[model samples]
Target: MDCDVLIVGGGVAGLSLAWRLSPSRSVVLVEAEGSLAYHTSSRSARQMQPSYGPAAIQELTRRSIAMVEGISERLPAPIMVPRAMLTLGTETEVAALVAANANLESLTHSETMERSPDLRPETFEASALDGTAMEVDVPALLEFYRRQAIGTGAMVLTGAPVTAVEVVASEPAGGTDAEGAGAEDLPTRFHVTAGRHSITAGTVVDAAGAWADVVAAQFGARPRGLQPHRRSVAIVSTEHPVDPSGPMVEPADESFYYRPDGTHLLISPCESVPAEPGDAQVVDEDIAELIHRIGEVTTVGITGVERSWTGLRTQPADGLPVVGFDADVPNLFWLAGQGGYGIQTSAALATLAAGLLTGTLPDDDGWLAGALSPQRAGLG
Candidate 1:
């Protein structure tokens, strides 16, 4: 099969980029899993907060949320639902948070309790509220991109892990031969073998989430030192009826967070333990510690753990995504290391990456282009 771009991942990152680029270019997406979103994208907190992550990520997330909201009417169901985020901490911590972000509304202990009655009064001295947070319908969003990409003639293959890649250098312009042309002067194509399928493409995108660096290595590209961190979540039954509309609560330090999920509460320790790329399993000790912490911070007694799961948040050393072409490997692009913000920032990142791939990025986005560049400083 011949394509303009070959994407090696089936998560939101790859799917979104396929949706964007397929309309203009011949695109093919291959996934190792039997179905799409089998990894981190399927195991998200499903919330988009503008105050989350680093400044660049926040910008991308804000743009992505706007894009999602703009297209909500066309989708089968609403993708973004209102869900505020309440950050609790000591008086000193709260003051620092207010000083850092002007958008956060500082609240006294009394005000915080009024907003979330489940919180214990003695646990936190003050809190801050970010009312712009929303619960994302991840399934609907992923499906939308998949349908759009397929509708636009993009080929999507499942259970097809890329096994080998051979670089075929195109002759330089002006009839220059390979031996006489400089490496930078030659354009490159890739012959990729993934499972039973063989594909040839002008550009190859590594969007393999936790296995991003591994994929880069296969293409003779330098690994970007991407680390996969395990983040675990547990669903526990609450002794009292939990309000469905209640705000998601977390510490200012981000030690743990919880939100209402019907009659139960979904809690996470916000742990980022270094892990290998594979199916992440829940640790009983981590869940026990999270339950103990929540019990101390809130009056909502956790009766039993209904279920639990874990996901990997792959990140670079600088904690930003790596987009754009590799400095050494010609025609190879990276769309990885999105960390915990992949789902929230998928739309904007996809749009930016598509522009970079097609060489149509606006002049005003030079800063973003530099920030997410695979060759950017601090990525080592």
Candidate 2:
């Protein structure tokens, strides 16, 4: 198989980039599992909260705000649903939220309660609002990108793990040509083996999400740092008649948060523990911790834990996604390390990935340019 770009992971990172690049380039997304995005991407918090994480991460997320706010107006009508976000904290955390947060420009008790009426001020010392925060239809959004990519000639292959990748000179592999037929062109090419089948492409994208570090190493990439961590969330039966329109909440310094997922609420410890990325499962201790943290905020308790799961959020030390060609590897691109913000930041990231691969780097979105560069993480 011949392709202009080979995307390793079929998660949000890989699928979004492939979709964006497919209009003018031959992009192939390879997923190790039988289905696309079966891992962390599928197991997201399923909400879009713009404010959180490090400065660089915030910048990328800041770019994503407009996309979230105006999803219907921009691409699709229902990708992002309006569900105001609230950040509840102690007095000190409130001050921190107020001081550095332009995203949460205005704060008030009435305003805060408007988003999450169930918030109890007696328990929380202070609270603020991220009025811009909203719930994202992550699966729909992923499918939107996938449909766009396939419609534009991008090929997606599931149940295929890239076993061996030998960087040949540069030739063609699989997939339809300009005339819509599978063909290969050029001399020596980068040979990528999936199962027993071989494919080639001009450039390969390491959007393998948690497995990105391993893929990078296999492709002769020596990354400065590619860190992966595990975080868990529990979908419990709050069986209480909670408003579906309730805003997402982070209690007293974001120790934990609960987002509305239909009648049930998605509760998480908002904690990240260092771990090697792969198949992740929920731990009992972590679940206990999550329950304990939620108690500190909500008067209502987890009546029942319908289900629980865990996933990996891979990132660099400096905490921004890598969205361009590797600093060392010539044809390899870094579209990994999105952490928990992958679904929210996919649109902008796809643009960055496309621009970087085509030699047209993105313009300075003010502080955003320096934030997204891998150099900040010492990867450059």
Query: What is candidate 2's CA lDDT for residue 75?
Result: 70
Clashing pairs in 1: none
For 314-371, candidate 2 gives per-residue lDDT tens digits of 8887677776666667788788888888887888778777877786765664355456
lDDT tens per residue, model 1, 234-347: 889988889988999999889899999777899998999999999999989999999988999889999999999999999998999999999898889999999999988999
User: For this target, which candidate reaches the highest TM-score against the unseen true structure?
Assistant: 1
TM-scores of the models, in the order given = 0.96, 0.88
C-alpha positional error of residue 370 in candidate 1 after TM-score superposition, expressed in Å: 0.7
Model 2 lDDT, full chain set: 0.76
What overall lDDT goes with each candidate model? 0.92, 0.76
What would the C-alpha RMSD of candidate 1 be, to one decimal place? 2.2
